[model samples]
Target: MHEVVAVRATIPGMTTTVDPRTVFETSGADLDAARAVFEQAYEASGFLPERTERVFGYRFRTVGDQTMSFRSTRFDARMVGEVDSGDQVSVSWVTDGGGVLDVGRDELGLSPGRPVVFPTGRPYRFELADVRQSVVQLDRTFLERIAAEAYGTEPGTLVFDHTAAPGVEAVRAWNHQVQEASRIVLGNAPVSVLALADTARRTALALLTTFPHRITARQVPLPTGATGRVRSAVEYMHAAAHTPITTTDVAEHVGLSVRGLQQAFQRQIGVAPNALLRGIRLDRVRDELRAGTPTDTTVASVAVRWGFAHLGRFSAAYARRFLEYPRDTLHG
Candidate 1:
């Protein structure tokens, strides 16, 4: 049976390091112990073994709220495994070994140089042989916050399409970013909270751009009539107000031409699409300024965070809306 022979070590800067050596036999007990190690690192599921009497090794490290893991087996053995990711998305790259992953209705071949993206709340199965891979687990809340900031709306049910492999250039870029993030999080260099936040935001944005998802406005169906179209467009704008999107993007998203979308909004919402977008962004900025700490955050930072580029205009609009200056709200 596999035995826990090592103690978990916690390093400075929120890092956890663990190296667990497991002995596998012909019994089910060893299998359970092996599965426990996987569960502790990522998600838990069944591991069906095709051979016996092998040693399994696992090395895990966590840095700045991200979990990284390396897993390998001593002997060549065919195995079937499944995992339910719960609320965390896992990005895995096969460093030295290869396998096949069955996600949803698609079976994808996993090999060196090809990275796999696993969305949260999805079940995936794998048939592995001598698999040695590194996995990074990103929290769902963190990703959703980044998405909301980028798209100007609450992103519901973020999905990653894993049916096909991403492009080579994209994979290389992501690998570079992942390595840089790891270095920043694990290295001895001092990192500020804002710097780390920026890195995380960039990484999350890159992932979203590289992978296709269901968050686009085009995926949303327009209602049966013009009023329905207007409603959909406004809802999309309100949700995406924080994003740097144009009226054209909004119109295309709701399946309308620019003129059509404008006419619909003017008739139904009594405001143009651009006006609605600006108003929503202003509201978001005001809310953040009111809720943020003045010591750690500034009015300019709050305005910039919500996509208000012109400081003078933003300040004037803030005063007009709340009957007080943005600085006053932040200080209070």
Candidate 2:
């Protein structure tokens, strides 16, 4: 059971009066004014949109609270939402122009007039300009129930590959109808709208269970001896992403001399171990920045965590590589 509440009440401890013109405008010099209205509306609804006209998508919103929100121009943009890894998921219909979605690692592409599901706990980035999309989140338990009922038993993992699946059209049509009904429920008795939402949720589960796009299973043949040892070392590095690891440590773990490890990494992974380590460090830094770590987690701390002792040089190198101030990124 879900509760669907009208999103019109003043946010707790915040003022409700805000300008819609600022929140929803075609385009103009009035953008700054619009931005103010947008900010206020976002805060009131608990979903803030940091949008550029060129990229008309909103991001980082919470369910029910509305952490992000947006609307766009006449023409729209098409995008896909995916549930790659998470406990819960929901499908949404509507995509195009200036809409943003968090799709994680699944390379699922959504054309216009398609419905997509975005599962929780996966990292995804989607960008589209000048469009609008209705957002929906699915209940994980509900989906699993449908999956068991439809497909004998649900696997530990399931893939919805749109290209391979034949039932995408049906799911799309069903999503459109659900979205329409949602609008009506939202406008009418908003308090009891949960009944309609629950129906949509159940329908979505049934549709997804039959969704076309089952990913083809591929076999990864394992290598023998030296090659396998080298592969294990590389895998270890990736798995220990947050730790400050060293090449000597890696070589010892893989039962190889330091020089041998260096040779193997260069020959196979095409990069030196230290260079690969730096790449991983840089990736970790980006991830930390995106996840909204504490402001006190400064650039210096980031560098030190990655094994860079010199603050000045580390900042310079980071700027040259990422094209932005390290401090700005850390704080932002």
Candidate 3:
């Protein structure tokens, strides 16, 4: 039977804590009961087990919150099943026994020291023969958003296509990174919000980098019309101001460190790059609001499209910048 332990899991990058308690724990020989537990543990819906013959011992345990999960699973049986990853992403390394995951196109052979993302966002099947594995489940939504932000693009572009690492060296590196992140996240000492958030971010970045994926180089916006770094940065801010680009992103685009960019902007433009970016985005928001209608779109929606998430803060900034409120401009 499943033991639902009530333990709080810390929000990544938030002032919270994940109680080190089991989220799911069960061990039984009844195939039907085991199947039910499996489905519940993974939050998986479409689980069609073809055969789980002679289930000698099956144990499952997981910890962590909605952001991520660390799971230990052992099934001593000839288990063959069709399972989906609940539209989430999972990476697992087989410590004992073996399995093959088929995404209805290609197959992934589960081996030791090798972590693989179960071909998700689609139907997949697996056959495990008396296996024990450690699994890390990541919230696809959180991970993808981080990925997109890192690349200065919107989410859902990058896809983890290959299941295996590029080589042996890559495999070892991946294992080390995962283990380190696991230690910080599932460790004894309480972690800082910054530490936890960085851990999660690094893990997500490592996962995407280690596995084979189609990711294009970020077209760091710079203009041929501009000569100096500060000028180029200004041009970039004006051109793609609505993008999810950050000060650091702008700095790198203009070939300067964050501090260097700040210094340059102060020297040349008498203001920080961030200030200029915010002013540009604010102007873009105002322009959009003035052109848009309440029936067509709301002021908050227009503001969010330009990276203004908090309505209260955005309203204050808009008023300070444009001498009027965002809603006033829209209604005008």
Candidate with the greatest TM-score versus the true structure = 3
- Candidate lDDT scores, in order, read 0.63, 0.49, 0.71
What lDDT is reached at residue 146 by model 3? Answer: 79
lDDT of 1: 0.63
Provide the global lDDT of candidate 3 against the true structure: 0.71
Candidate 1 lDDT, 193-256, residue by residue in tens:
5666667777777777666665543323323342334655666776677778889988876656
What's the CA error at residue 171 for candidate 3, in Å? Answer: 1.5
Q: What's the CA error at residue 172 for candidate 3, in Å?
A: 1.6
lDDT for each residue of candidate 2 in 225-283, tens digit (9 for 90 to 100)? 32334555655566675676788888776656799788877776567777766666776
Residue ranges of candidate 1 with Cα displaced over 4 Å: 1-32, 50-58, 66-78, 188-195, 216-332
Q: Which segments of candidate 2 are over 4 A away from where they belong?
A: 1-85, 93-95, 98-110, 119-121, 152-158, 162-172, 176-187, 190-198, 213-332
Lowest summed lDDT across 10 adjacent residues in model 2 is found at 61-70
Cα TM-score per model: 0.51, 0.37, 0.56
lDDT of 2 at 215: 24
Candidate rank order under TM-score: 3, 1, 2
Model 3 regions more than 4 Å off? 1-6, 9-22, 45-55, 163-165, 191-194, 215-332
- TM-score-wise, the better of 1 and 3 is 3
